[model samples]
Target: MFPLGDTHGGRIPPLNQILQTVQQNTDSLKTYISAHHEIAYRSIQQHNAQLAMFAEAAKLQSRGLEQFLVSQEKANLHIREIVGLDLKALAREKQAELGKEEMEKREPMLRNYVHALADFVEVVGGRETQSQNGELNVAASVATIKKAEVKPRVWRRG
Candidate 1:
């Protein structure tokens, strides 16, 4: 394709608010809203699709909020110590940002979120199964996994 013009169609056409263009934009917006409503506004039932969707959104939003903290803490923050989970600094920062009155009002909801987030992270990432001491936790007789290769003797006995 020559830079001059592979085809005149590729060249920028004059911007116009034609009916077809308007209809396309409307269709796309409706689709987007429909999808969001399906994931976020559905009635809770025997299955928790809405909760799962909100949980995933929370993880993404948490990372985004991390960028806005006035002073980001380098140390890991624990949202709940009993879980022994290390969460992003923003988790602690956001909880602290709530006023004393608001915190009291939201205590139960916050507790439930902390517990759910820990369990979700553990299940999805499989991190909980690994021992905190850097060893695999299993009931098998096998002791340790030997990932490193056994090198050949430097001076072989011929």
Candidate 2:
């Protein structure tokens, strides 16, 4: 025989060594999985935090826009009120100017009318004294007075 036991037979590892190696590999795998889980968890948390920040920013932007619109509406209403008041004041000023112009124009015509009426009265009285047509002349004078007393019609646009 070459040897009593086979050569290199005792070089094989024991069962405890194999079991320890498998346990070490399992522990390493668990550690790797735990590290990956931590990384994924942190990523999810960061994403959620970013989403929350964006949502808050959007809310703030919406509120700011609403406030801006409200302020603009208020400004526009104020401007309209100012414009309305300005228009009213301008209308009143124009009305006063037109009244002054109408008065200035009517004054001279009224004076001329008074002078003509005086001359007509003097002539009519003289004619009445010199003629026997007194009744017709008085009737004509009364008719003229009636015509002068009538009010002039004024037309206005609605």
Q: Which candidate is the best by TM-score?
A: 2
lDDT for each residue of candidate 2 in 1-158, tens digit (9 for 90 to 100): 12223543656566686788789999999999999999999999999999999999999999999997776655544433332332223323443655755635544533444345334444444331333243344445435533443211221210
TM-score of 1: 0.23
* Residue pairs in clash, model 2: none
- What TM-score, computed on C-alpha atoms, does each candidate reach? 0.23, 0.48
Off by over 4 Å in 1: 1-88, 127-158
Give the true-structure RMSD of model 1.
29.6
lDDT per residue for candidate 1 within 1-158, as digits (tens), equals 22335534567433463455777889999999999888765554424876788899999898787763422221112111322433434344444666455645655544454444434444534433223222122211012111111111111111
- Model 2 TM-score is 0.48
